[model samples]
Target: MEKKRSFPKFLSITLIILVVVGAFIGWKAYQTFIGPSVTDKEEFFYVHTNDTYDLVLARLKSQGIVKHPDLFDFAAKKMDYPNSVKAGRYKLIPGMSNRRLIGNLRGGYQEAVKFRFANVRLKESFAALLGNSFEADSTKFNDILNNEAVAEQYGFTTDNFFSMFVPNTYDIYWNTSPDKIVARFHNEYKKFWTDERKQKAQAVNLTPIEVSTLASIVKGEALHVDEMPKIAGLYLNRLRKGMLLQADPTVIFANNDFTIRRVLNRHLTIDNPYNTYRYKGLPPGPIMMPSIASIDAVLNPTDHDYIYMCAEADFSGYHAFAVTVAEHQVNARKFQKALDERNIKK
Candidate 1:
């Protein structure tokens, strides 16, 4: 027996209910489409220079970093990020919002794989590192390393393939080309050698290549960084006195296989031109990749008269320097005893 509601009140209540239901549905839809849908976190996406906007958008959508490809296209057009995006490898994470993901792509937040070449002995290792980044032809790289014509064109001597490379960590894009990378390394090497370094080389009567060759030897022999200058002085003094360099690393370099636990008496008899035990001057090329510290040490050696050196029995990153043959023999005997105790033989 209740009275009927007014028309205005009835209409108001109906509209309010419809509005609430519609708002709820719209919210649910937005929530469902807001973030990435994928669950696998390890998979990554790579973008290249040749990728178009449509292609990038599709890749982002497939990777689950973006909720919709249309949203990326709209944002890319609005924000002008399409032209700004750089090519590289990017890790796509789930639940990443569209705006932030596009920002990452635009700003080029791609992970750079650090390539290090410390203590690398052969040219093949360099080729391998470059190959990983560029998918470069290893055969071509090896040919470049061995090609006398190319070496001469690059101002490198064909005999010393290892000398041309300096040891350092370089940040390289995953898609870097091997030819470009080799050129960059050569450029870095040139930048490190200033006019002052050239003058120092001239003062020591060493050509640029010879200086680097000596530096490579210093790098290999010096167990510690601080011992480089002293080692350089010992070798330089020997060279001045016209004595045999007799460097062990040179023999290893000539042999090409550096697996000898101890350089044997017979090993010294292998007559390659790089064998400093038989040759009077520096080897035709660098034996290993030289560190910058080692290069500087060769340019500015300590003013000592040391003509011979033997590793310290303690292996404390120091060498026992000797000015005469008797002292050298004593130091050598001490080193030999230490080696024997450690089960290392020569």
Candidate 2:
């Protein structure tokens, strides 16, 4: 009887030990899947194209995003995250669980980048801006912008294609292709030129691209928004009378020297198509991306007989306008004296 009692007691003890071990394992699994495994601070994780799962795990550990790498690895493998990794810029919130983080990453939830550009001086700079913002590099964007066939494919010529990008804030994905980026800008361009705007362009005797070209010159000339209309009017009058535009900004653009503060006689003789002095009318294309205010100014220019414009001698961001050559000479002299006094030689 004593031997029988001992055997039953031993079996009961073995059963209790197995139950305790199972309960402990269940608790560990629950904590790994449901408890917070991310760091206290929010972070960003990037998975580049062609990145391996091991690389992603290493980056997560290096970034200090995962508090328990071993536990995270166990959960990730169980959920098959290794086979479903995605490339993008991902936002990692604070105190997130391992299961939730892996789920978001595996599901390809990407955070958008806010893309904004204005006053870009050249296509190269524009390409560089795109490269810095997204996965596509400057070379890719440049190839698309410079390709005549690509430009023509989108109903634009290479010379005028720069005007297609309407400067504004846009929400874009980080991994967007270069072609898609250009397509997006083209769509926005179409939306920007409404029927009313087209009619206004017709009323001004200019096409949309031509207006954009003129608007760029006006934008370069005027530092104040209120002064753009008058400056645009002066140029329009010159264009109508078959006179040389003789815009100083065009000369600077032709020289390819944005640092030239004072336009000299030598800069006017560059013989480039962009030199308004040498050209009889508007330049071949825009010298820079024009702003919305500048574009509207060209569409609604001030009706006036002003034939010439010179920077004000008062050092204010304003211009002095005159209708006759004699009056223009006087204003030009005052501005010349001001430039001479400031020693702005170039």
Candidate 3:
């Protein structure tokens, strides 16, 4: 009887030990799957293209976002997520589970980059801006801008390739290729020229490029939007009367000297076709990337007799318009006097 009792007691103790072990294992699994895995304060993780699971895991550990890297590695392998690593910007919230993080990464969810650019002086600057916003190299982007053969695919030349990009905020994936980036610009440019705008261009007897060329000059001349339409009208009147545009901005553009504050007689002597004083009509392309407002100012120009414009002598960002050269000379003299007083000779 004593031996039998001892055997039963031993059996009961063994059963209790097994139950305790099973309960501990179950609790550990629940913690792995449902309990919080990431500590507070982690917000982002960048997994570069072609990053292996080991590399990403190392990165996660290096970032100090995961407390139990070993547990995560095991969970990832068990879920078959290690082989399907995705490249993108991922959102990491505090107190996230390993299962949730793995699933989020495996699903390939990416955050869009809010990219913007404007008021650039050259294609090189534009390229730099795009390079900083997107993933392309700045030099490669500038090269593509100047490549005529590549530009040919987009119906542009090296000279007019800059016209494709309009100033706006574009929400796009961070990894968008340079060609696709420019393609989106082309698409936006096309959509901007609506039927009404096209008809307006026809009424003005100008192609879209011609309109843009003139608009760029008007934009350069008039620093204020309110003055842009009048300046645009003055240029249009000059074009109609077979007179030279004589735009100072064109001279600066031809010389590739953006530093010219006051265009002089010497600047007017530039032999480049972009020099409107030397050329008969519009230049081969825009001197700068004109805003849509400026383009619309050209398309819907104000009806006026003004054929010339000089910067206001008051130093305000406005212009003085004149119907005759004598009146223009008077306005020019006032502005020239102001320039001399301010010692802004260029």
Extract clashing residue pairs from model 2: none
Q: Say which candidate scores most in TM-score.
A: 2
* Candidates 2 and 3, the one with greater TM-score: 2
Residue 264 displacement in candidate 3 (angstroms): 1.9
Candidate 2 per-residue C-alpha lDDT over 77-188 given as tens digits, one digit per residue, 9 for 90 to 100:
9999999998888888788898998888899989888999998989999999999999988999999989999989887789889999989999888888899989998999
Per-candidate TM-scores read: 0.77, 0.91, 0.86
* Candidate 2 wrong stretches, greater than 4 Å: 1-27, 40-42
Candidate 3 CA-lDDT value: 0.85
The residue pairs in collision within model 1 are none
Q: Give the alpha carbon lDDT tens digit for every residue of 43-77 in model 3.
A: 67777788899999999888887778888888889
Local distance difference test values of all predictions, in order: 0.78, 0.91, 0.85
lDDT of candidate 3 at residue 66, scale 0 to 100: 76
Q: Output the lDDT of residue 259, model 1.
A: 79
Weakest ten-residue segment in model 2 by summed lDDT: 1-10
* Native-to-model Cα distance after best TM-score fit, residue 270 in candidate 2, in Å: 0.6
| lDDT for position 44 in model 2 | 74
